[model samples]
Target: MRCWAIIPIKGKGEGKTRLAGVLSASERDALVDAMLAHVVQAAGQAGSIERVLLVGPSRHGLDGAIPLLGDPGTGLNTALGAALDTASGGALAAIGAEGPDRVVVIAGDLPCVTALDLDLMAQVPAGTLGIAPDRHGTGTNALSLPLPDASRFIFRFGADSRALHQREAERLGLAVETICSAGLEKDVDEPADLTDAAPVFTPAR
Candidate 1:
């Protein structure tokens, strides 16, 4: 099956605001850029992922190889829905044509995400949905859905999103596979999160 990974990123000025207590304006911008680069690199390196779609404001300084789907400047769910629509609407023709299509939505702030984590998420059986919750196990850090059925579940990304996603999956009668991976769980949101992620945020030598 063909797999497409969609990463939703906010504009530089609008992102990582929660970490303002520790990171300066420039530092937060750099951190967001670095994390975006790392996420894209990891998705590109995943053997199961055929394409990487960036759903965000603009792709000016990002890696040119990955495709960008301009966000509608709405909420997270709306942007994600737009990305999914684009992917399912002929952008990824091979997915449903040959076999089942897999769509993976991941947070751009997961600095520690690796190709292995992506590969594991992609390994979910056909007709099943995979979820990787955040470090605290309350928020969803990553999700894998098998389309077109994937559209049934609404994207509720916030406090207790993991439970919300699971309930949505159950409502749709889709088998839920909860995946736990340290690389996929860690996310930089607060000053403390940044401190914990510092080891992985080193500048490329």
Candidate 2:
């Protein structure tokens, strides 16, 4: 199957605002870039994924090679939906390649994400949806969707996103597979969240 990974990032200096009390602006930017680089590497290494696409205000110099889709200045869900629409519209075919059979939307803050974690999501059955929830099992950390089938799937990235995404899948008659793994659970958000990815962060002082 031709699978692709899409990672959406906030503009370079604007992410991880919840940790404002603990991290300097430069520090926060570095952390965001570091974590994003990690997620991108994992996706590139995943055996099932054919290519990686980024959607956001900027690529933040993480990798000049991967293509980026500009964010519509709306919100996360809208930006993601636009990306799916672009892919499903034959952007690949225009380049003499087959369109992606599946697309996985992965949060850029997952510091510990690995290729195996990504492969698990990419391997979900053709008619099923894969969700990797946060450490609290409340937020959605990553989503694996079969293409064309889930072309119009709405992304609910806010509170209770995990359950809500599952419901969204059910609404489309797709089976939901909750893939919980350590690598997929740790997304650095609050100050306390720093513990989940201490190795990637420099000393606050």
Candidate 3:
């Protein structure tokens, strides 16, 4: 099946405010950059994924290698809406040629996510929604679905996202499957999350 990845990134000094006490402004930005790079690389490495969309503030300085979409500079949910639009063409191709039965949405903060996680999520049966909650079981760290329009969910990346997503799916008459994926559940949002995620980027054991 053909797959695509949509990663939404908030500009430095604009995200992960909870970790500010533990990391300097530069440190937090660096961590975000690293996580984004890792996720993009993993998507590129995944055989099933044909495209990766990096959406963020137009001025965000990501190295030239990654394709970036200029967002309208709004809330996280709005940025995500734009990102999904950017991925539409690829989504259409996947559906028509590559079997767009499902597309994976992963946050840029998930440093621990690996190709294996992608493979597992890809297995979600057609017409089903798969979600991996954050450690708090409130936010959704990763979600996969074959819905023709993923934007219908209206993502709001906050404490109640897990419940919200499920609610949205239920309202749409979509079946939801919650998975306990370690890599997908772990996100670098707090200082502890960053510390825990550092090893994933280090040389393999």
On lDDT, the leading prediction is 2
**What lDDT score goes with residue 149 in model 3?**
46
Q: What TM-score should be assigned to candidate 3? A: 0.84
Ranking by TM-score: 2, 1, 3
Q: Which residue pairs in model 3 clash with each other?
A: 94-100
- Residues 34-53 of candidate 2 have per-residue lDDT tens digits of 88988999999999899899
Residue-wise C-alpha lDDT for candidate 3, range 98-167, written one tens digit per residue: 3344668888878878888876776777778888899888898878866474546566667799998888
The parts of candidate 3 lying over 4 Å away from their true place are 58-65, 89-101, 149-151, 200-205
Task: Write down the TM-score of every candidate.
Answer: 0.90, 0.95, 0.84
User: Global lDDT of each model?
Assistant: 0.83, 0.89, 0.71
Cα RMSD (angstroms) for every candidate in the order listed: 3.0, 1.5, 4.2
lDDT of 1 by residue, 1-205 (tens): 8888889988877888997777677777788888888888899999999888888888638877667786788889888987777676644453433333889999988988899999998888888999999989999999999887776668889889999999988888899999999889999888778765565464232
lDDT score, candidate 1, position 85: 72
Reference-based lDDT, residue 100, model 3? 47
Flag the better candidate by TM-score, 2 or 3. 2
